[model samples]
Target: MKKLDYQYALKPDWQSDARLEKQTTDNQSNIVNLTLSDNTGFAELNPEQYTWLLSFTYQSTHKKKSGSVCVILENNEQNTVNHRQYFEAGETGTRYLNLSGLLADYQTLSQWQLVYDHCLLMPDATLLGFKKPDIHHGPILIIAPHADDAELAAYGVYSDFSDQVWITTINAGQNVQSLDRQYITGLDDNLKDAVSRKAKIRAWNSMTTPLLAGVKFERLSSLGYFNLTKNTFYNASEKQQNDSVCPELTPAISRALNTMTLPNDESNISSGKRLVDDLASLLDQIKPTSVFVTDPEIDPHPKHIMSAHALALAIQQSGHIPDRVFMYVNHLRKIKKFPYGPEHARTALPPWYESTSKFGHYSCYSHQLTLKTQKEKVVSFDSMHDLRSKPRIQKMLKAWWHKKVLKSGYQFYGYHHYFQTHIKANEVFTFVDGKTFSDSLLQKE
Candidate 1:
């Protein structure tokens, strides 16, 4: 397997308008001041229509073994924009920061400063010309590996074009230990009963959250596979001979899987062969113009990657063609506090650790959201039962100390709070046509 830096794979081609190279001495530690050689592009560049990004090639000098490193851009008025991202020790590569929010007009950008708290500039390059992507229309089908995934990754998308959307979740049969503690039967409920209740709650959450986006309940469906079981659905031959042992037979799962009436046989939800077959079946049914799935390679979650693998297998078998396929990264290779900064900040390009010889199999696009739409996205996340914060008073007190006394932001707290990473001013995706997606993504046996 081969891997590539995100920048070369994602960034649009641009002729460098200007360049800078230097280092800060001990007296000038952590700061570099520079003037642009040309400001003519500023007049034509509107932050509304374009994404203004400053690219930096730098090496970190900080001694921290692991965690995110911070880079900041400060204007003449002392206002600053910062991006903190994960980095390996001594790693060197080009990183990007979004300047859209900080930029108002050409007049205000006469002087700017670069601040690297623990990094030293290797070389500087500015890429000035790129337009924000327009929202693609649908008949869109979103594939969710787990119940909360669609809402976490693209609530902004489905919420924006709700009537044109259909959501199909792969895993609604979850056994949440957290739900076990919430005594539904007043102490009579055992593990099996608790798990059934958990499935029902999440199934309801998946069905209803999209309704707020204007997607009718009928447009949503679940495969009802047990949570985190997508990775096991690949061996079609093995599954055809015998039924899987852990089947979701609960009434709640049946209701979630079938829209009009309940299913009689457990085969649909119980069999791995059935899961793959049903996915292809939906492809033929929806005939979606655009489809969204998690990037199998870039997303770190095993179930998420397996979900993409299943989609690839389904497309190969069904031969149904979609106009576009969008792959989004939610976990981002285990980087917890990515899309970093405050929750409301606009997303920039994700960080890259090194340049790659390979480039351009897929292009990156950002789905910019209007403020009204962003608010609606928040409402969708808040509505999901799984996203609700559980009581963690001890963890909270430690976090309070981390933020208040120690003065380090509670950076680790957002690790599991996906809303913090995903509910931003925009969502990003690596995009390819359906044909390329099907041809390129061959599932591993």
Candidate 2:
């Protein structure tokens, strides 16, 4: 295949003036070294207090390749940290190498030794740092617009901080056709019955999956709103009763589907004072120091974007000031087949597009997972009924056709399902301080 160049529309410069430039080389030795001229202020930094990263922009050449690469960094004492990133044939973007595990302090890192496999590294590279997600600051809250989003994007964070983590899923009543397929054959052939059944299963899945991560069962809840129904709640008056999208389901399963009474059982679901009020109430009650929500700027899904907007409104309404907020993207706007390689591979930054913001301004944090934890994530996703159900015939056929005829692998089915795309060696998040998060959303509105 003759590869064509696919480059970012804007210059991928996080810090254009950063030192450490390298000349392009073809099949360069796996190892390279750079010596920092100035070590000022390096000793002042504390490794345990922050997660450090080395970032560089790169342009992939038009050549037939494995589409994956690894970078190994060696400090002055020969302590090394391994980083991996995948780029498509002829793809261009930036890569961030995680440097958190190196034992030496920054001051002792006067010399740099890196081992690279493929692709071209740009002349400029810079170092960045983000505050660690420490539970001692306060409890952590993770917000998901749909049932599986938390597992898909940040399972590692919640798993690691399970002792103090609270997960709340919004819009768990999505009427996906997979639910219909799974139940229609076994139950009375009514669409409403199938949808209702799905609501219960998904709601149950949302409330239970985190248990595997040692998260308290009492700490899990769902808003139970219908798919694409946030707008209805936002537009209606707080007292006005919005009709249930899935009326077949009981009040408990469809509690937040309408603005009437809500669920108060072990599984809490609500839409009181509209959806925003429900979220604000949770914020006020939990008093979380750190929060996680979908990134509105880069995630293309409508519900994901709306969920972030709702969170911003809730923050404004409650006057709760979280120390920090983590934003993740399950759906990058313009790219398809992202995280770009095999399931076992490491995921760096998502490829940037014309509209995507430049990287350096916001703190980028990569939550690296152990092999054991990755297996745990696989189990967590498997518990979600929607992901495990049989694929539609059309989807199966499309995936087969793509693999056999087009030679392009299927991302949503077969080998490349959630097991592949979502289960990566690292989960990357954009770290924005709570004040900045609130201010940015407000400005956008």
Tens digits of per-residue lDDT, candidate 2, 118-140, equal: 56666566665565665456899
List the candidate 1 regions with Cα displacement exceeding 4 Å: 1-8, 11-54, 59-92, 99-123, 126-134, 177-188, 227-234, 237-254, 257-267, 332-334, 349-360, 369-378, 402-416, 443-445
Ten-residue segment with the worst summed lDDT in candidate 2? 7-16
Could you tell me every candidate's TM-score relative to the true structure?
0.74, 0.77
Q: How many residue pairs collide in each prediction?
A: 0, 0
In candidate 2, stretches whose alpha carbon ends up further than 4 angstroms from where it belongs are 1-28, 62-67, 73-82, 102-112, 178-180, 183-188, 227-251, 254-273, 354-361, 389-416
Residue 391 CA displacement from its true place in model 2, Å:
7.6
Q: Write the per-residue lDDT of candidate 1 for residues 344-371, one digit (tens) a residue.
A: 5556656544343121365555565666
Winning model by lDDT: 2
Global fold similarity of model 1 (TM-score): 0.74
What TM-score does candidate 2 reach? 0.77
lDDT scores for all predictions?
Answer: 0.61, 0.64
RMSD of model 2, in Å? 5.9
